[model samples]
Target: MKIERIYLLFYGISFISAHVNAFDPITTTLAVGIGATLGSIFKYFQEHCSSKWISFNSTGLEVDLENKLFGQHIASRIISKAVNGFMNNDNPKKPLVLSLHGWTGTGKNFVSKMIAENIYKEGMHSSFVHVFTSELHFPHASQIEIYKSQLQQWIKGNVTNCAQSMFIFDEMDKMHPGLIDSIKPYLDYYDKLDGVSYRKAIFIFLSNAGGESIIQTALDFWKAGRDREEIGLSDVETALSLSVFNNKKSGLWHTSLIDKNLVDFFVPFLPLEYKHVVQCALAEMEARDLEPDMSIADQVARDLIYFPKSERVFSVTGCKTIISKLDYYV
Candidate 1:
């Protein structure tokens, strides 16, 4: 049933039921109807337009990035500050658009989860937080047109329901070209589109599209005997965006999302080192309510494969397999 109809039925029933006597047979039937309508109304508001779900805790997000997330000073800082500024703004120019780029296991999805957890009480499972994976959601290249239409409609409908909604597009590197452009209108700086304002919304794109560039930059910093923390956004942001834009394999290749600068921040997640992997294992153990064992954490981190055989400076998988590795050790 439509939300408007549900609302009318709910209020109308409440009025009539108030006047009905407990002894009347009609009261029981009316009571049943009221229960059904109330359920529908509650669900509609919860899934649709409830601001009660969105409560931005900037301090919590900062703490999460500091503790849960490892070896990503650049990503942790950018995400914390970006989210804080956007959430505090009552009138934003446009929806906050963040494009996170890094190799597998570098905490792109993990950071996304932290953001959701700090924003909505339900975190990733929140109805307002929508995640779409390219390989799963848009598998067929032949159905690009259908995917575009469905994508646009889904975004528009959800935004109309709640302006504070969040849409996360995962596996963006695999998304078909031009398919992402369909929602470009929503990301642009417009007060309203079709009378629906999206300024309060947030869009995050996760991809391995610029992994090579990011890895190379990190590798260079290591080779130079420079601290990874010293390697800032300025070092990789331009190259990352360019490489992603020019690379035909990327979803953002030659896309206006880059050309028009619709992407507010291209957050780079640096590859994790051996120490970071150990930290991940230790953190995972604590998450499972187990005492953190340094010896086991070291064993798990050492077992993982690392690159640059001579130096072995970086974990090839960057704590991606830390969980399963922990299972075997513990």
Candidate 2:
């Protein structure tokens, strides 16, 4: 299972060479052919199976955050550092637990995809990656108990199959109050739970729970003429966590996940400014295989709403509606 310990083909070829002198002409040929087939099978498995499929490109991720992701410098830095450190560690004490807090269209889901793409070869479609949206997966409050059992089984089954499996939970704010706590054991420091080790797995929670506090902190910086990039985790993390923990409607409300300090990072995604929205439009145009037209991008950005009535410092929906807005133009 270890990467460096594989010697499938070498051992097979050595065995075939050593035994060839002892066999009849026909038998020798058959033995060699069988050895080669077995060797190929093992080599194929080694190359395509779990753990080996992961190729963490930390440099590539940094470049992506710098070039593709716009406006949320704090999020970009925290995500890069946290994921890089976690991925590089061969024996992590616990799973990497990240709770992304921000308003809609602020790149919570986008960043999740970025992380998945960097870690897994197939990106979001990898068999080991699992995504759960509260609205779709856990819609009924009456089925909380059913959800708890099913969720635990699903996590156990997947992690048992691949230790490095990723579980992304979207719409955490809308999730049932006590629903998430069921999987707290998997996220803990324990090396294994019932023979399955979750230390190498990852858990990402995407929510709008602490968005208000995050926005307030960002707006405070803007009003005081401080650079948006200057706002660090120190400025918003404490408030953000507290806001999410206290909000009764927030999924983690009074939950032990935060109380026990199980959440590794509460990354704050700041609201996008007008310029950032324009950047999103330009990026979208490029994504669509069209030239990056500033005039059209500017028009798309202008059509969207901004906040702080007088100053219009930030986009109300960020780049959430940019694609549709651009569709109207082109």
Candidate 3:
């Protein structure tokens, strides 16, 4: 009887010990899972609630950026690369130039649509990786941190590499000063990056940023001064700068503005496109037409387009370079 009792007690103890051992593992796994879940929640809150996060530069135009700043030759160069040769179906295996322009409502919205709706369906990026973030917003100081982080995972190189993915920043005047300050280094390596990586893209900074800041930049920081402005051009010599960002010569780039600052390349729209843009004004009756000069929109356009620089404070010394290039390169 004593022996039997001892055996029974031993059996009970062994069963309980086995169950406890199994429960140990379950408890450990449960703790780990709970900790992991809390950690993830904390991280998400931190990022989302952060005051400002650095975001990547916008992808492409949501609509057309207009013909005022973006002229035919620039458009042709870009469109050609986009279609690979003006064929209705020409598609490149890699992306093309990054286009930027001044202001909104210039029809810049359609840029990406043309690529995504038209180019992608026809199979443009051949090795066929997915397009991450078909859309993007222009980077602000607020989103720089977040954007830089995202960019690290999505892209491997610097701004010059932005062209590899067809990066463009329209209305660059609004870009944060910090962001512009960061881009100069990247511009220096442009050709090397593009040559080494066929997929490397161009970064076009379209700004309404010019004048005293430009001349000052030319004189001080970049030392691009008179040399950078060149002498042979015609268009910008006498034209009043209509907007802070529009380029008078109207090309995709300020290759002439190279070695200069964003301070240098800005210009205004012409009379040809401003109040004159309203061809229907001719149809108005004499009374209505009498005050056509006084129309609010026209006056605003006039102010924005013809702000005085009588001090000759701002003159476009660079358009000559464009005409010269058009002369030789084309």
Candidate 4:
């Protein structure tokens, strides 16, 4: 009876040791007969690591918006709405869709980066954050079908694994027409469909299709002697939407996504004035741990090309080139 009891104890220890060894090598037999305890320890560590991996801090995002991004009130408000939607547990029924429309260097990508940074531990580098650029990922019109399949599969797989994933489609104005429509099903209003729920996901489209209209409106406001801050979403929402829809080259053009009002917000990135450019220069300098000088910022801002040779309205490229130009001053 004593020998049989010893055998049973040995067998149990062997079994537990094997499982523990799969995770980490046992340095001592002190772990023997404590399989349940060891398993709990392993689980705790796993949970700790996972908890450290995914982090979303709303306060951090607000601070970034105030400091990093400048002259983008409408865009900021729309982004806040999207972030709030993601964080809200009550309204998890539909994905937050944002159509970021503006010219290049006007903070579309910047705002996307800010959102990713605040929402994910890895930020823009997060595996769950997928960015597809028209110029880089899907340039050829013939490859639209392939791109559509890949995009759908990618979204489905990631959302299945983690519903809080984010998809950023950049340069939509340059994407192949009708290609973006493949995502309509996921963006549609459904409680649950096709055995998957994409309600917790977020989709952001960055495009320059309606950029001209946005800039023109802002310019018009400037000419009318109105404070640039007075320009609101109500001022440009209709024109911007119509421009993006009517423009044949726009990826959203003739697509049900826009017509059906699947898009939650048409966040316009307004053209940056020289003062905004100066602010960007100062911010960039501060980012590099250098004390910023207004004289240097003024010089950098002055070098940037502005629109309407007559009025010299605003920075044509916004703050896109501010960092590069700062190298000369620093």
Query: Which candidate number has the best TM-score?
Result: 1
lDDT of each candidate versus the true structure: 0.91, 0.91, 0.34, 0.85
The residue pairs found clashing in candidate 4 are: none
Rank order (by lDDT, best first): 1, 2, 4, 3
Candidate 4 regions exceeding 4 Å error are 1-52
Q: By summed lDDT, which 10 consecutive residues of candidate 3 come out lowest? A: 49-58
lDDT per residue for candidate 2 within 92-152, as digits (tens), equals: 9999999999999999999999999999888898888899999999999999999999999
Worst 10 residues of 2 by lDDT: 1-10
lDDT preference between candidates 2 and 3, better one = 2
lDDT of 1 by residue, 71-188 (tens): 9999998998899999999999999999999999999999999999999978898888999999999999999999999999999999988899999999999999889999999999
What lDDT score goes with residue 11 in model 4?
69
Off by over 4 Å in 1: 1-30, 33-48
Error of 1 at 210 (Å): 1.1
Off by over 4 Å in 3: 1-99, 108-119, 122-153, 157-164, 180-199, 202-234, 237-330
Query: Which sequence of candidate numbers ranks them by TM-score, best first?
Result: 1, 2, 4, 3
Candidate 4 — worst ten consecutive residues by lDDT sum? 42-51
